[model samples]
Target: MPIVSLPVIWIIFIDIIAWTFFHLFISAICMRLPLAFFLKDRLLFQVFSWEKSGELWQRLFRVKTWKGFLIDGTIFLKKGYSKKGLHGTRLNDLKIFAAETKRAELTHWLSILPAPLFFLWNPLWAGWVMILYAFLFNLPIIIVQRYNRGRIAAITA
Candidate 1:
């Protein structure tokens, strides 16, 4: 039920290009937001009692087994805290790392918000695919951020 149409190949190309742009655009904007906005645990980032300091993700997704394999977005942006690994063991460093996780999580979540816009030009199935792509591209990063933040909480608590 798209309002416009394009060939399958064009759709694929656009999907790739558009998603890349969306990710970078979102990250760029998020990086400019005040650090204080990400310092607090609120909304989607709050760790619940059941999470057990992110061990939930380890049990459910074996996050540790694959998390290291995921690309660090900081590599693409060339600015921002690196989530590739913890940079320091000091308390202040850990706190900053935890805050950056919140920022990273929000960025990925925001990146997914534009998936519906793909529907304007793609076929119904392709639009659904775009939504799927959006989640696939961003969700793992969100999961990592949440897990890392939870671990940091365990450390700081």
Candidate 2:
């Protein structure tokens, strides 16, 4: 089969690069706020906010609980468990926090793809390309979430 035109390939590459950069910029802006605030305000819990799920998992695992989502952030739970009993200072809590933070970071990074750009043009190929890229980028997270759920189930069992 004949190869795609150089211009078309260049456009695709530009789209990918532009989308990636856009996501990175957006994430940088959003990360400024406390992630828990975002999780609470965004109704992220309904979506099974990684943070919430992680907190649940840590409680299941009997790990220490910490505050903030990122490793670079402050760790608040060093003493008695919080009044709510959900609070505890443990390494597992910290791990869950870090993992959820990374998941959020990854989601933000992937959001840069200009999903609307495909709609701007009527070309069938453009739509196909965007769909393929979206599936490719999202598959990993889907798999990981499934795997984590399974792990949680096993631990609970």
Candidate 3:
């Protein structure tokens, strides 16, 4: 049987908007507050840290090929701006990149919340697709954040 049903697709559409908007709001709050600083010390952050995902294949994914054109194209994540806001030493960049990575990782974790909420509607394929899209959109950014953060951490350490 098909994973998604036609009747539930509309609910899935709304779920997608909610997923994105929720993260955007969370991102804004993170920018204003020191959530990243707090999360840095939390046990939860450890699971999402760079060390867990760092590997030969992960490095290969972050390479500046076609994938970079899509994820890093964002104005904020543009080029090396994420690590160095145009001017900063590698160690200083680590501090900045650390915070960025924390926020992205947090946002990625929160992205899955809406999927189960929508599952109450019927546990259809549409909800699953939204969850999958959330992963697709967030995972690359998360990988990039962790990849660069690892480099930054090395320089600072």
**Which model scores highest in lDDT?**
1
Q: Which stretches of candidate 2 lie over 4 Å from their true place?
A: 1-6, 38-43, 47-113, 119-122, 142-157
Worst 10 residues of 1 by lDDT: 36-45
- What's the C-alpha lDDT at position 60 in model 3? 70
List CA RMSD, all candidates: 1.2, 10.8, 5.2
Off by over 4 Å in 1: none
Answer with 1 or 3, whichever has the higher lDDT: 1
lDDT of 2 by residue, 84-122 (tens): 222334655543443344444345345635564554442
* Alpha-carbon local distance difference test for all models: 0.88, 0.44, 0.55
TM-score of each: 0.94, 0.45, 0.65
lDDT of 2 at 132: 74
> What does candidate 1's lDDT look like per residue over 61-126, in tens digits?
899999999988888988888888888999988988998999998898999899999998899888
Positional deviation of 148 in candidate 1, in angstroms?
1.0
Q: Which ten contiguous residues of candidate 3 have the minimum total lDDT?
A: 77-86
Please rank every candidate by lDDT, starting with the best: 1, 3, 2
Instruction: Give the number of the best model, judged by TM-score.
Output: 1
